[model samples]
Target: MEQFYLHLLVLLVLSILLRFLIAPGHAPEEPPLVSSRIPFIGHLIGLARYGNRYYVRLSAQSQLPAITINIFRQKIYLIYSPGLLAAAQRHAKYISFEPFAALAIRRAAGIKGNGPIVSSSSEKGRSSFDKQMKDAVHSVLLGEAMVGITRASVAAIKKSVDDLRSTEVDLLTWCRHVLTMATTDSIYGPMNPYRNREAEAAIWEFDSGLGKLTLNFAQRFIAREAYQAREKLVKRLLEYFEKCGYINASSFVQRRLEVERKAGATLEDIARLETLMVLPLLSNSAPSTFWVLFDIFSRLDLLEEIRKEIVQNALQFKPCDDSMGKPKQMCTLNMNNIRDKCPLLVATWQETLRLRANTASVRFVSKDTKLNDTYLLKANSIVQTPANVLNVDPNIWGPDAHLYNPRRFLDTRASPGAGGDRKRDRKWNGFMTFGASPWTCPGRHFATAQILALVSLLVMKFDISPVAGDWVSPRINHRSMALAISIPAEGLMVNVVTRKEVKGIDWEFQMMEGKA
Candidate 1:
């Protein structure tokens, strides 16, 4: 009798454990597993060798809308179907992004584990550090809070363009430098640490080492140079704040300090957290701006059309600069008008993202969840919505999906056919580069405005030609594993001469600002 009771108790305990890790027997089935030929390590090798393309190629192996990839015995729901991706997003409360965010900061900052779950704001003042930081970040980077920074950045861009002189330059180097300077000057105010040469270089170095740092596995030895680079930038940032740099900073920086201080974070903690804020400003935005310029310039017809579009639709003229005693109209380009009115320019931007922005919207399933009543995701699963896969999926984008077709978005829609009801399934979830609602990038509005402004000015105010003598698309740097949008594998040399017509004429950027 004693033995029977003990056996029954053990069975009950095991059942409870299993229940948490899996769904109930009556629940929906988990996504179908796509077994690999080489078994356990095949997918790992594929990822290391092929980088992001591994997932794209893997889709050919299975017909599942979503596949269960076995990563070292852990279930990773690699969502391929737009419908499943939407469902996962809808059940965000259970398939959470917060835990992963907290983990990323914990690992990258070298902080001791302080619990990996970022509490929901619904709990309000109970505020875990990550939750507080998220709230503070959203306060200024999203909605109406973005106008001040947008205005300042536009002014900076206008000044940079006005100073442009004919010169031979590397396109990537120029884009990174110009965009970083313009963006940081606006957000960091007068004491912007990135203005210092060492601090400027350090941001890129830290970013290069970010992949290893976020893995948090003996990163000091493996990514020594990058680790030191981060420390150097952190030191400069610490000095910036100690000297009351926040006094003149953008609301984004101000809110960051206010929230972290309230959470009793140390100065170092605040600096480290701010490091993440400075990331997209320098990292993603520059490459995106570079691609847009490269694409427009490579096709002269497109360049002229973009220039014409801006001139016709976005430009406003006022008699402000009559310095030469010859009447001159100072042209003001309304960047918001460029964003809204120029369909071709907007389409070009979207095409570049679809083709080159390789990223996955990753989440952690903290509780058993049903995705649109069709699929069940168990707790302990990792969910990844790979935009790289969906962006080029033939089913969603049609037969010519692999090619860059800006016309696809001229109607403000994807090429259609993402499965199921097809009409309703073709929603915003199909575009995952900036991700979907709730987890959508907070800085996207500013980034878009900045990129469009830079492209608009370059095409309109200057005559740029490749030093190679014609337009040749450089191959992407495939080995840049840590980055989402890869940079050019080779240098693109260009001659930039201010157009004769625009010389000596003052031009200003009229930025349209509202909700982010």
Candidate 2:
């Protein structure tokens, strides 16, 4: 034992010397290298043990806008400084996300080689998949198309909530089901595969296994469940497409089908690609909805305040079709008013996302590039910007950066999170949930509408109490950075009681034109 200790001590001393004295010489022109105290595999071990929070610790010690670290000698950069992040985004063409997108999409779909991703491309290198998909999806997520989808999703939320009977239910699990059905209904019409229970289960299983599945190595044995789940979803979706499901689907689905079919992709290939679309539509909203409600309900004062705000601003009483024998009175929830009139609700939603979302925006340096007038990002190097670190940065989001504070938006006294275009988004000025331009999450508006509708309508109509009698947050699954919004490792069962005020009153939702 003593001999082993002596050898390890010598290695430790030698590694420190080499890391400090020698590693700097290798990439002096690039960003300052923050090497590990251990040799060769130190950084990799740190990431495995600490996950992205490792970057937070490194940022604290180094205090650099951007820092470089090695993973098995491969240079990877982490950027946190708001200014530097903005500067890097300005060079989006050079630090392209397309390369990573192309590769990741192919791997996730279990496709081989360079195939057209739902659209024909004029040139290869940085394939047009990301850009083409972005344009098609974003075009419908706003204007009239966005409203149409929002109404459909809102209606689904109503039906789901109406079925509630004050029973014990897993909050996160329930959120996932509600969102899966609602989002899929809006995006895929009535025939969305997720409307079936088996397909719904498969989607979550597939998502849980996405990180391993994307590794694209021995998936049948290693990520067998995820791989199998992907095929399951693809098979169902393939059937949907074969039956001309897009005919009755929203313009969103119709538009994507047009783009993919024009590319001459087989129905199976299009089904595989379409499965990818369901991921973003449902992933963030479900987890994020859980967090926002959890944050509010955990604090009774905030819960009452938000609930009151929604009732006063958005709620309406109206007559509806009879459930049995007589005309029934329905409570209409004006979604636009919920979004525009209820400041506390919107602020809470943003704050919850700020704290819970742990996303890393990764880009492949397509060409050697200079950034912040100091660092040289060499071609083939990897660039990462973890939103979690920036979201909690004390320098940008104020001293209570780590706390859940919705007032940060209402105060009108916060930093712009970065050098933000203040006018574009006044409330969520500092949020990194939806990233910046070029690669900004295209479904952001539609997502916001859905979250606000789901959460506000929920709290307004139901009183949720943890079955344990107190709100104890579940241990978060921090290991998987693939999901931006970190989910609870275990489910939290809560006893949901429909408020006396909402009992026997049918609930409906509307997105009034020019009001939402």
**RMSD to the hidden true structure, all candidates:** 7.6, 3.6
Residues 1-516, candidate 1: write the lDDT tens digits: 999999999988885575445432222388777766654566778877777777777787786688777755567788898878767768878887776666677667665533222223433443355666678778777757678888888778777777778999898877878888888999999999889678878888888778789877778898887888888878888999899998999888888788777666677767776776788766888778778887888887888888888889999868864656787768888877897788899999988887886777678999988787777888988898778888887777778988977887786443344445453346345777787766788888888888888888888888888987978889876555656576676788899988898876678787644632
Worst 10 residues of 1 by lDDT: 113-122
Model 2: worst 10 consecutive residues (lDDT sum):
421-430
Candidate 2 displacement at residue 170 in angstroms: 0.5
Off by over 4 Å in 2: 1-25, 118-122, 125-130, 318-329, 412-429, 514-516
| Total backbone collisions for each predicted model | 1, 1
In model 1, state the lDDT of residue 449: 84
Clash tally for model 1: 1
TM-score of model 2 relative to the true fold? 0.90
